[model samples]
Target: MRRTTDRTAPPTPPPRADIDQRTAERLPVTLPVTYTIHDPAGPIEGTTVTSNLSGTGVGFRIQQPVAPASPCRLRLTLPQRTDPLHFTGRVAWCRKIPHDSPQTFEVQVGLALSTPADVREEPSFATYCHFVASELVKRYLG
Candidate 1:
């Protein structure tokens, strides 16, 4: 029995939206999301529900496909917060697939937190991340 390692070869990357690539655990927290994607043609505005939340990003479905790395503005309201948290980040990924019917299509987009990451230490987002960490602890330990 023997094993070999390809040191020079790059490691395989997980597919887009794959859970394995997430550095933090995702909370099945569905929050209200209002997004404005600045597409090249024009700005697309829509309201959709968040599918999941993580320390690094948020996932939601959009009516139109957002190009990867395209800048976008996201307004999300966390639990017990009346004023929504505003985030500006490039679209991490977008997956277009058929939904409800074959004739209809929806795009699921992942938006990374870029602005708040460098602004004011991102207190609001940090708080949410803390909450997620605690919930994960409760699920796995408590």
Candidate 2:
């Protein structure tokens, strides 16, 4: 009698290229942030927390859906600086977050900044971004 063997191939890997499309790296952070949506008539302001931060953008959760491409202003205090950093950006995208509760349906918004312009306009912003990226890299990637 001849011996028989069964062989199984390994599973396919995830698509890393699609995931790494972002030009700037993102750091997972939970920090309190206040945001203002610019409107033609008047500006609407609200308080929320940042989910992540990068040189080019930020992510946050909100109670309501924000229209894509809407202009926004963000304010948050980083550990390196005593004063808060202000950023001007636009709503890149928004998606509904599923929850167990019926009364609450939170939305996650991706806010992307108009790079180069912001950093060049504000010297402090450039410094703050550098500090954040360096610190995050040292702590996690170093």
Candidate 3:
């Protein structure tokens, strides 16, 4: 008896060129962060790791569910920064993962800085650069 061999082509995936063009520039730092989730009833606080941050928004992973398109006040504390950053943010999107997963949901929040121009003064970046410069100076001179 001869067995038949079937050769079938696999399905092609959708083109990602449009997605690449529309995607925003993502910063390359994973800053430790603590965020507070503000709701109508009250505020719920949680700890999240900032996957990436830009002048206008940040992406983080949280356990609790946050409604998309809802506005919230966030008190974000970054590592090595003296003062916590506070701002008003809106939930741009939320996605739930599997139940057994450590990260229950991924939330992308868009924050409105107190002043749009104030982003240049983001303490985290400024402080980090200052520290690095200081360290380099010490290493070279000492």
Candidate 4:
């Protein structure tokens, strides 16, 4: 008779505590973003589409690797707005998705807007989401 070893132990998963600290509020709209890395010697510019935006930050995809801790200046054009909005941000984390995929990168950036007063005063959260949704549909669909 062959002896079989007990294999009832559950698999241990990697820690995800960092994910809790980095929770972000998602905006309903997709904004067009042009970002430039601020290097003292010179600046490197790149253009990408923002997946979503929030009062605290924005999320986007990069074609290449960007230094995680580097600061960048972002010029975002909202769907409804005619002028581009300018904001500064620090790259919180940059990681390549799909393990072997080299054509795309996911970046989580923390924005530092010029001032707190710059954000519009909306009466409620639903109103804000509605406004953003409307703009996104108008620009993307219309």
Number of the top-ranking candidate, with lDDT as the measure: 1
lDDT of 3 by residue, 93-130 (tens): 55554456665534344333233345457654454344
Which lDDT tens digits does candidate 1 get at residues 1-142?
Answer: 1213211224556568845553666667789989888877688898878898777788888777766667888888877788888777777677776788887987777777774535448876666666677768887899
Could you tally the backbone clashes for each prediction?
Answer: 0, 0, 0, 0
lDDT, residue 20, model 2:
62
**Once superposed on the true structure, which residue ranges of model 4 sit more than 4 Å away at CA?**
1-24, 39-42, 99-142
Worst 10 residues of 4 by lDDT: 1-10
Q: How does each model score on TM-score?
A: 0.74, 0.73, 0.51, 0.54
CA RMSD of each candidate after superposition = 8.1, 12.0, 12.3, 11.8
Model 2 lDDT tens row, 14-110 = 5587576445676787767899876454576788788987777888887776666779988887775677877788877677776898777787777
In what order do the candidates fall by lDDT, top score first? 1, 2, 4, 3
lDDT of 2: 0.72
Q: Please give the lDDT score at residue 89 for candidate 4.
A: 67
Model 4 lDDT per residue over 1-142, tens place: 1312122223447658767654344565566789987644456687877776665567676654555446788877765566676666666545454335666444444343333442455223333445556655666687
Error of 4 at 53 (Å): 1.9
Every candidate's lDDT: 0.73, 0.72, 0.53, 0.57
